[model samples]
Target: MITPIYRVQCDGPGKEWLSLPEGHVTGADVTADNLIAAPTAKRACNWPGEKEAKRAAVGAGWRHAPDSDFKTWFCPACQSAGTRP
Candidate 1:
């Protein structure tokens, strides 16, 4: 299993805590599409997670790809890319 990246934060009572414990890795994949009429027109451009992920990616400097194959969750910039790795 992959070890999750840790996000440290100061607790309400001034204690440091690991917001993300571990083993929270994300995964993504794309599907095959074909359209002889137009190449660009067949592309999947509408990324559903764009709004929220972009904000987080801007603050974090870098972002990971979508967390699932279904476009359910993703970091900001990754969502902007709108392509699975």
Candidate 2:
């Protein structure tokens, strides 16, 4: 499981600058420190609003970035295009 608070490599990449590998999140990562097995140094998307958005993205087989300038989560296809200027 992985959560993004800033730019990161997600999926194939185009600067998705995003995770949770399905079973991993529900398995080994279930009780691994925080809810998502993300890097402790990195700020996770723990904010309420961002959390909701992230949930949606995960359900859609994509990743979420609350810091995105567009203010919307992206599916893999859109994630490649939603770059920060």
Name the candidate that leads on lDDT.
2
Candidate 2 lDDT over residue span 11-84, tens digit each: 33332323333344333432222333233324333323555545544654555465665354444565556542
Considering summed lDDT, which 10 consecutive residues are worst modelled in model 1? 30-39
Q: How many residue pairs clash in each candidate?
A: 3, 2
Q: Mark the regions of model 2 whose C-alpha exceeds 4 Å error after superposition.
A: 1-54, 66-71, 81-85
Pairs that clash in candidate 1 = 4-23, 53-76, 54-76
Off by over 4 Å in 1: 1-48, 63-85
Q: What are the Cα lDDT values of the candidates? A: 0.29, 0.41
Per-residue error for 43 in candidate 2, Å, reads 34
Best by TM-score: 2
How well does candidate 2 match the true structure in TM-score terms? 0.23
Q: Write the per-residue lDDT of candidate 1 for residues 36-81, one digit (tens) a residue.
A: 1111222212233555333332343333334533233233333345
